[model samples]
Target: MKKILIQQLFITTLMLGLSHNALAEDKKPATDSTPRQSTMIILDGSNSMWGQLQGINKIVTARESLKTLLENAHGNINFGLLTYGNKKKSCNDFTLVSKPEDYDKKKMLRNIRKMNPRGRSPIADALKQAAKNLPAENAHILLVSDGEESCGGDPCAVAKELRQSNPGLQIDVIGFRDEKEAQLECIAENGNGAFVVADNTERLKTLLDGVQAKARTIVNVTGTPVDGNLPGSIEVSIKSTHTGGTPSRANFSIYRPDGSNIASFTSRIQVKEYLEPGEYRVKAQWKGQSYTNKVIVQSGKTSTLRFDASQSGMLRLSSLNSNKEAVKANYSVYLANGDFISRHVHQDNVDLRIPADEYRIKADFDGTIQEKNISIEPNVDNNHVFRFE
Candidate 1:
């Protein structure tokens, strides 16, 4: 009898221990297995933000719209703030007021409201500075500006350089109260982003809402398995055919079967996302070449897509007068078969990426057409100078 009682006590102790461990496991917090996205907002604190629209202060409108965006972005996105021309009249007036932290809405909104626009707009330098604060991949820069670059910096060139160096960084521009600023659009185009204009308070709020919605999509995990591995997913891989490696820069724009955009993200080599089981469209841009394809995803499975960049070379074209000094000229790129590719104006130096082949460039220096034929090799930077007599 004593031996049987001892055995029963041992069994009961073991059962109690197991039940305690099970309870502890159930109380643990759930974790998400997705990479977080980071964004740095470059606010245009230039004097123009203080301008008035319909008796409403532009700065007030910006602050209010940002407040709404921050409120909605709470707990969903990581945000940082960089501002220029807020305190003084110097070209180097930009400051990183807030570093990107996980959903710190209150701190970011406070910094935005305290901005006092009083100085010049060093847009180019500001953009470069903003890029430094972001991650090398899966990051964004939202540039809100009301005027042009007053500090003699080429914002377009800087934007292109930023994208080239950090292939994963996207630069978006919001032209507040100004629509005729072509340079702003150039900044967005070269930075692989969008340009939108807002002239009034209500419009500014609505536009900001749109931007925030896109931001959410960017930061949300797209191609990972869910808790139970029930949702479908897709992974994309980009590489170069010449080196058989990832290209220096590439852009991916994913769309639904109904032609609506799902997400536009940049990656040096690869990206993944989780979604519903369906057919999706993917458009990839690299080295001035674009390729589109379709992908299908099924439940509890991952669909893999691959894109290879063709052997392409870069042509740096410039024009000079009889004095060997740079001058404004119209340039056009054409294939050897006389097929036109594109055109540009007032670009002292333009970089054109073309497949490895023969090409012809025409430069119109104030109506005097100068033509030159050249050959481009794979992964080479070919420079050509058009000297007008």
Candidate 2:
């Protein structure tokens, strides 16, 4: 009887741990392939960019990186440049440096090399003008900054509004130094992009390359009630032939009959919910990211939904030496009960695919033993890397 009780408890914990993800079985969103996307580069010409790093000025690095990016972004990839250095102090000081144009390698390199970093960081104004500046309806903004707004502009507010105005618009931000990461992250999310840190000027090239790669993804969503009734939750199945890398956010636009924006959120690798929907548009936003698809929302039967990166956080572990190397030995992971969650023999990584929760992780490998309690959250990655002899 004691053993039965323990088994029941383990089953209960496992189910409860994954309750959040179970909602995907209820409602499913349609999937559709998307078209090619364009990009807009928002250059932060603040004096900080001109500062020296590793005996190399960042602006110079930015220029070189721009040349490399422009040359390799493929012919379909167009470009645009918005510089804060070229702005004025008056209310009408906002200007458009270069509208969205063909990726002219020569012109882009020249502009970057000629960039004279000056003035305060006017992020808000630059974003506002970016919207007015870019020609394509579906485009992304690459915000390169090292500090907060010196010109007292609310960049996040502007980016959010711009997203509402432009359905597929996104903003990918890279901070050069340890400034306000949280604030800038919001700006990135508002634009439906990702925020990253550039520890050095050299990373500018890699960062932009990643952003460019992420921009090509395009996912389309269409929604309709199930059996003429709306369910408590919606299950969206994502089927795509992706080559490599990950798409940041699932673009969603709740619209009225007249096709005006109502509510929008970037999906976090989970089936989205809270639907009393009429008509909606869900598009994937990333720089070079392209997909040919439609997001169909069905209201009736629960359908399975898949996430590129499961908001569900989990970890795979293996016993390792002090050198942080996996050990070639017998190992097994178990729940509080004796039920085997996973086991290994000389394996480097073990699958710990689970929903967000805290766990007492134990390991026995190579005749050495260790145990650890681990936690996995929904939106953020869990912090747990273990090694054992």
Q: Would you give me the overall lDDT of model 2?
A: 0.55
Candidate 2 residue lDDT tens string, 1-389: 99999999999999987785677644333223344356668777776776764677767666666677777664335577777764443333443556665455577768777777766677888787777766555577877676677676788888889988886686777665454555676687677665555544333443454444433322222443212433222333233334243434454433334445434434432223323323333333222221112234333223333434333454656555878775654545443433233456666556555444455666666566677766666545444445663
User: How badly does each model clash, as a count of residue pairs?
Assistant: 5, 35
Candidate 2, run of 10 with poorest lDDT: 285-294
Point out where model 2 deviates above 4 Å: 1-36, 86-95, 200-207, 211-389
Per-residue lDDT for 1-389 in model 1, tens only? 99999999999999999999899888653346444457788888888888876677778866766677677553445678899998899998988887665335667787888888889989999988877777665677878777889999999899889988988776767676455467776687677665555553333443454444444444454743232323445667567756657444577777877767765656434444445567888777676765466899765455789876667788888989999899989998777776555688878888877667788889999889999999989889999999997
Q: Let me know the TM-score candidate 2 reaches against the reference structure.
A: 0.49
Residue 206 in candidate 1 has what lDDT?
Answer: 38
Point to the candidate with the largest lDDT.
1
Query: Which runs of model 1 end up more than 4 angstroms from their true locations?
Result: 1-33, 200-389
